[model samples]
Target: MSSAFSLSSGRGRGAARLAAAALVWGLATAGTIAAAGTATADEIPQNQGGATATIGDLKTYGSAVIHENGEDSWVSAGLFEMSVENGGMLQTYGVDLHSPTQRDARYQETSWNGTSLSGNAKAGRIRWILENSYPQVNDLAALAGKAGVTGLTEQDAAAGTQVAIWRYSDGADVDAAAPQAQKLADYLEKNARDLAEPEVSLTLAPAAVSGRPGERLGPVTVHTNAGSVTVTPPTDIAAGGVRVVDQDGRAVTSATNGSRLFFDVPAEGADGSTSLTVQASTTVPVGRAFTSETHSQTQILAGSSESTVSAAASANWAAKGAITALAAQKNCAKGGVDITAANKGDAAFTFELMGDEHTVAAGVSETLTIPLQEDQVYDFTIGGADGGGKRFKGVLDCKTQGGASGIAAQTLSEPSPASVGGSDGGTDLAETGGSGLTPVIAGAAIALVLVGGAVVVLVGRKQTPPQV
Candidate 1:
C-alpha cells in the first residue's frame, strides 16, 4: 500500500513516446519548480535620490591647537553644511570633516545604513555649540569678552570657536590658539546641551514590487550607515508567518550592511505586503553623506555623530503582473496587435493599453485588436491597473526600418505541467484516474510510465508521433 502505481494502457496515437516524454518532462520541470521554491534574490531598484549637494561660503571658524606628546597643531573648524535629504536644510554643523571636501562634491552621496545608540554624548555636546554658542549665536564680541581675551581677531575668533567644538567632537583636551578662545571653548562645553541623535542613517531600496500568491520576488538589499541592526520584518496575514525571510527561508530579525533580503510568500497565500522596518544603535560610518534629487546639494555628516536610526521598506504583492506582447504585420508599414488572454487565477480584471480598457471574465478568453501605423512604432507596455484578479499583460512591436518583423506574444507565467488537465488518446479521464503526478508519487508513476513507454515506442516507430 505504501507504493501503489496504476498502469495506463498505451493503446492509441504514439502512446509509448508520450509516456517516456511525459515521465522525463514532468520530472525535469517539477525539479525546476522545486528549485525555484528556495528564495531567489534579484536586484530591486534602490530607494535613494540622485545624491547631490550645494555648499555655502567657508570662513575661518577658529582653530583647535592640540597638545599630543607636547606637540601642537592647528585644525580648522570652518564649514557648516545642511540638507535633510528631504528637500529642507536643517542648519547642520560640521563635526568631523578632516578630509578635504570639494564644495563641488555635493553629489557624491552613496552608501548609507541604519543603527541604534552608538556613541556617548560627545557628538551631541559639540552640536550644542552650533545651537547655543558663538558662531551659532553670531556674537563674537560678546564671546571674546566672556572668554576674557583681548584682540580676538576675526580669524582667532573663528579658530577659537572651532577649537572648542573639536574638544567635544573629537573628545580631545585641545584648546584655541588664542588664550581667550580657550576660555570660549570652556564656556561652550560648560553650557552645551545634548540633543537627541539623528534617527535616519540608512535606506531600503525599492518602495514597491509586485508578486502573486505563489512567487518569490525581489532581492531587497539594505543600505546602511550603521555597523549593526535589528530588522522588524513586515507583518501581514497574507504570509503564514511574519518574519523577513532569508535565501534559505530563515527569519532574519537582525542583519548588517548590504544584507540581502527577499519576500517569501507561501505558494497558497493570498496577496499582501507591508513594510519592513529596522532599527540600530551604531556610529554613522565615516565619509558617508546624504544626496539630493532636485539639485547638487548635500550634507557631510559622517564619522562625527552617533544615533539610533531606523528605516522601512515595502513592496506590492499583486495577484497578477508580467504580460507578454505579440505582433503581426500586414505589410512593411502596417502592424496590428492581437491580445489573446484568459484568467481563472483570480476575479475579473481589466487591462489598460493604447488608450482603451478591455474587461475580461476571470475564467474566459478574450481577444482585442489594436492596429498600429508602423512609422517606427516600437514597444508597448499594457499596464495592469485593476487592483486584483488574473492579470493579463500584452506586449507587441513592429519595425519597418530594416525589413519584415512581427510581434510575438508570450505568457509571462504559465501553469505547471502538473496542473494541466486533459483527455489522452480518446480515453475517458474519469474512468482512467488520469491526472498530474505529485512529487511524492512521481517515482512510482515513473516506473509504470517507463514500461508503458517501452511498449508504445516499439509499436509506434513507424507511425507519426502524437503531441502531448
Candidate 2:
C-alpha cells in the first residue's frame, strides 16, 4: 500500500518524458503479455512492446491509513482511476507506486502468471483475493450490506477492495476508514488462492521461400519457448525422395528453438510449392519486475491456461524443364549413347556435358554421343534455371541397331546432390543463412477501459515480460 496520490482525468500520449526522478514509479514483473487492438492470442507480433498506466482521480472511502514499519501513513484507502492509452479507466488498487504523486503518475505494467506466482505467496494470494472479493463478485449492494454498510458508494467499495488487495499484494497491514470496507478486507484475507498462468505462443520467421528445382530452399528457423517442435511437410516430398533437412542437409523429424530448416527439392520435381508447419505447446512460469538491475515487482493478470501454437512456412521451386539430364542410346553407332543437357525455359543454364563445361541457352539442347568400344556407365549433371544442378546416371551401349537396348534406367538422382553434400560439381546452389527473426510471446498491453461500478472489468496490453 502506498501513500495518497492523484492525477488528471484521462490518458494522453504515453511517450511522456521519463520522469526525472527514477524512484517516482515502479511496476510488478509481468508475465504472459498481450496488447489491445494489436496482437492477440490469434495473430502474432514480432516482439512484445512496452506498456504503462497512469493513475488519477483519487477517491477516499474514509481516509484509510496503512500501518507499515512501526509508522503509519495517511493514504487513500484504495480505488483510483488508472488511465491507459487506448484503454479506459479501471478502478485500480495499485501494487506499489513508491511515493505520492500529483498528476499523470504511471508505472510499467507486469503480470504474475507462473506456478509460484512470481515466487510470492502474497502475489498469488492477492490474485485469489481479486477473483473472489467484492468488485470481481460484482454484487456491490449485497456485498456492502454484508459488510454492514447501506448505500456504500462505489468509491468506498473500491477503497475496501484495495485495502484487502494490500493485505496480500503488499503484505502491509491496513486499517480501513469505512467499517464495511475493513470488514470485506478481513473476510477476503482469510481465503486467497492462486490462479494459473497462460500457455506461450510463437511464430516462424520468413514463412515463405523460393528456389530452383534442384536447390535446397531454406534454413527456416524456429522461434519459440517450447522444448521441441513437430515438423510436418507434404507426403509427396518423402515419397518422391525429397526431404526437409537441416543446415547440413541431414534429416530430422523434430526441431527445437533456433533450429534451421530446409526443403530439398529433387531435380525432377515439378515446378510447384508446398508449406510445412511446426507446432509446439508451452507454459510461461511466473513474473518479477523492475526498479533495479536485479529485482522489482510483478502482477498476475490472469492465471495461465494451456494452449497450443503453430506456424507455417512455404517452399517453391522452378520446373524440371528449366534444367534436365538425358541419356539416349544411339543404336547404329559403335555401342554408344548421346548424353545431353537441355534448357527449354527462359534462362541460360550451365552444366557438365561429357566431362566438359557447357552452357545451354534457352530453347537450346547440347548432346555428346560417344562411340565407345565397350558399354560405359556415365553420369551427367545439368544446371537449372538457377545455378543448382541435377545428376543423371545411365549405361550407354548400342547393340545390333537397338536390338537389345543396353542402357539401364536414366532419371533424376534422389536426395539431390545439393541436399546431401556438395556433389553437384561447381554448379551446386550456395547456402543462404536462415531467417533469424523470432516472434515469441510478448505484448504491450495497451489501453485502459472501465466496465462497471465496483465490477472490475479489466483491460490492458502486454509485452515480453521483462527479466529482472
Candidate 3:
C-alpha cells in the first residue's frame, strides 16, 4: 500500500515534521499505522513521505493563547505558536477552544529567545494598548487589567502558552522593547541605563511642630509624581541624609535612594511658630546598574522656626537629544534671519530658521532662512524670550523686488552683506565679523527677544539706531 506520508520542501517544510509527529501519536495511541481495519480520523493527513514523528515530539519551545466569547461563534483560538528553527522567523499558529464564552483570537509576539511565545486578545483592544505604549513592553497582565479583563486569572498562563517574542514589523524594530531589552543584556552591560539619584527642594509654611525627634513643623508640600505630597521633618534634621517625618514628626517613607535632609521656611510667620523652615534630602541605592547623582535646594524661613522637607532625584542627561532644537518660527517675505556659530551651543536655536539666537561656537557659519512681509521691519532680539540672561548679538539682512521712492521696488534684489543696522538715515551698514546690523525704512522692526518672556521693541526714526 502506498504511504500517506510524503516529504516536502520549501519554507514550510517544517509543517511536514509536525504532521508526521501527529500521525505517529495517533497510531501509537489507537491502532496500527499500516492496518486498514480502523478508519482515519476527521482531520486525516495525506502524507507523501514515510516520516515517523509523533505529536508529543512536535512540542513548541513556547506558545501563547487567546480567546473570547461574546458572539454566536464564540469559540476559536485568537493566537497560537509553533517551534521555529535556526534562531527565529514568523510562523502561523492554530488551536481549538472548548467554551462558548470565547469569541475571537490572534497572536502577538511579546518576548522571545529561542522559544517562540506569543499571546492573544480582542485584536482591536490589544492593538490600541500597544500603540499607546509604543516602544514600551507593557506587562501583559497590566494591559489586560487596563482593558477590563477582571476575571483573567493567572490560570490561563498554565495553558501551554508563554509570552511571545515580539519583533517590529517595520525597520524601527531596533529600539522596540523586546530587542532593546535583549541588547541591554547582551551588549550594553554596564554602559546602559541606571536608576535616578534622589535630590530635594523644599518650600515650607510655618505650622505647629511635634514628633519623636521632638516638636517640629507641620505638613509641607514635597514635589512628587503623585502630586505634591505633605511632609514634616524633625527639629534635629541635618543636611544630607535627614530622616523623613509626618506632620506630628513621625517617619514615613524609608530613607533610601540617596535621601537627604534639609528644610525651607516661608517668608510669612506661623502663629507662635518659628520662621517656616523646610528640610530636603534623598536616599541612595546601595547597588545599581548606573551611577546616580544627587542634588537639593532649600529656602530658610527668615523668622518662623517651622520647617518642611522635600526630595528629588537626578537621571542621565547624556542622551544626545536630551537637549535639542525645538520647532523654528516662520518669517515673512523679503527678509531673512541670520544665525552664526555663537548660536549653535543652545539647543533651542538649532531648529530656528530666523534670528541669531544661538551663539555661534567657532570656525562655523550658522545660516538661517527667514521669510518676511514686504516693507516690514522686525528687530530680532536674542537673549531669551522670557529674559533669562542668554543673549544673541547679530543683525539679519533682508531684501526683495518691491522698492519705492529712494529705494526702487523690484521683484528680486541681492542681499547687501551688512553686519549691523544703518546710521543717520544712511542705506549702508557695517559688518563686524558677520555679526553686524542693517537699517532700512518702510517696515516695522520686530525685535526677537530671547530672555525672560515677551519680545521688547526699541523703535527708532527710520534711521540706523545704536548697536545693541
Q: Pick by lDDT: which candidate is best?
A: 2
After TM-score superposition, the amount by which residue 84's alpha carbon in candidate 2 deviates from its true location, in angstroms, is 4.1
Write one digit per residue (lDDT tens) for candidate 1, span 373-423: 322122333332221221111111121011011110001011211211112
In candidate 2 the C-alpha lDDT for residue 72 amounts to 35
lDDT of 1 at 310: 58
Candidate 2 lDDT score relative to the true structure: 0.40
lDDT of each: 0.39, 0.40, 0.20
lDDT of 3 by residue, 1-468 (tens): 011222222111111111222322110111111101112121111111011110101112111111112101101111111121112212121111110010111111111110101112222222222232212222535533443343332222211111111111110111111222222212222122322222222222111112111223233333322223333333422212234454444465433222232222222322111112222222111110010000000000001111122322110011111111111111223233322221112132222214222333322334454433222222332222222211121111111111111111000011111111111222121110000112222354533222112111222223222221
lDDT of 2 by residue, 359-407 (tens): 5566566765544332223333333323223333332212111101111
TM-score of 1: 0.34
Off by over 4 Å in 2: 1-56, 59-62, 87-89, 97-109, 113-117, 145-151, 198-468
Question: Distance (Å) between predicted and true CA of 116, model 2?
Answer: 13
lDDT of 3: 0.20
Off by over 4 Å in 3: 1-262, 265-468
Q: How does each model score on TM-score?
A: 0.34, 0.35, 0.15
- Write the number of the candidate with greater TM-score, choosing between 1 and 2: 2
Ranking the candidates on TM-score from highest down gives 2, 1, 3
